[model samples]
Target: MNLEARKIEFVQEFLKLQNEEAVSRLEKILRKEKNASNERIFEPMTQEELNKRIDKSESDFRNNRFKSSSELLAKYE
Candidate 1:
């Protein structure tokens, strides 16, 4: 069946549900599916953008511009 017809049928079946736990479980599943779809909307960086980031990182390393693991740990402590 088409999407709208399927949705109407689902609603009809859902209305007939007598179990509260089953409805709650279906609600949780719907929420998880929605959150997953939202997460999939994020765009990744292009290869050129990635290369530029790598180049900047190398320049920072050459200039001794980054922190050390010990320095970072000391600051947190």
Candidate 2:
């Protein structure tokens, strides 16, 4: 069936659920998923933008401007 029809069917079945604990668990899962989706911040970058980033990173590496993993970890820690 279509999306709306599927949603209605799900709601009907969900309403038939009699276990409060099960419903509460499902509600928590759905809320967590919704919150996780809302927390996303990054958008997809264009190929040109990606290329510019790669070029900049390569230049920095060649100039010894980049930090090693251990250095970064130590600094952050």
Candidate 3:
């Protein structure tokens, strides 16, 4: 790559190590830009939707949609 690109990449990696908050903010900005580029993309889920999903996940676990680790290992063996 070009010298400028290499410099920018190094700065980004260094910032990721030295300033995690900056790195996280940069990632958030990039994700928003990517989502904005796609008009048909769905909006972010609301708090209510997230709570419902969490409840459903808990229910699924209680109903054993996920098998035990020992059972998984036994099946593999």
Top TM-score model: 1
**Deviating ranges (above 4 Å) for candidate 1:** 44-77
For model 3, residues 1-77, the per-residue Cα lDDT tens digits are 99999979977786658667877887798799888889667699999999999999999999978788999999999
lDDT scores for all predictions?
0.98, 0.94, 0.86
lDDT of 2 by residue, 1-77 (tens): 99999989989999999999999998999999899987796589999999999999999999999889999899988
Ranking by lDDT: 1, 2, 3
Q: In candidate 2, residue 73 scores what lDDT?
A: 98
Which ten residues in a row are the worst by lDDT in model 2?
A: 33-42
- Which pairs clash in model 3? none
User: Which digits, one per residue and each the tens of the lDDT, describe model 1 over residues 1-77?
Assistant: 99999999999999999999999999999999999999999899999999999999999999999999999999999
Which residue pairs clash within candidate 2? none
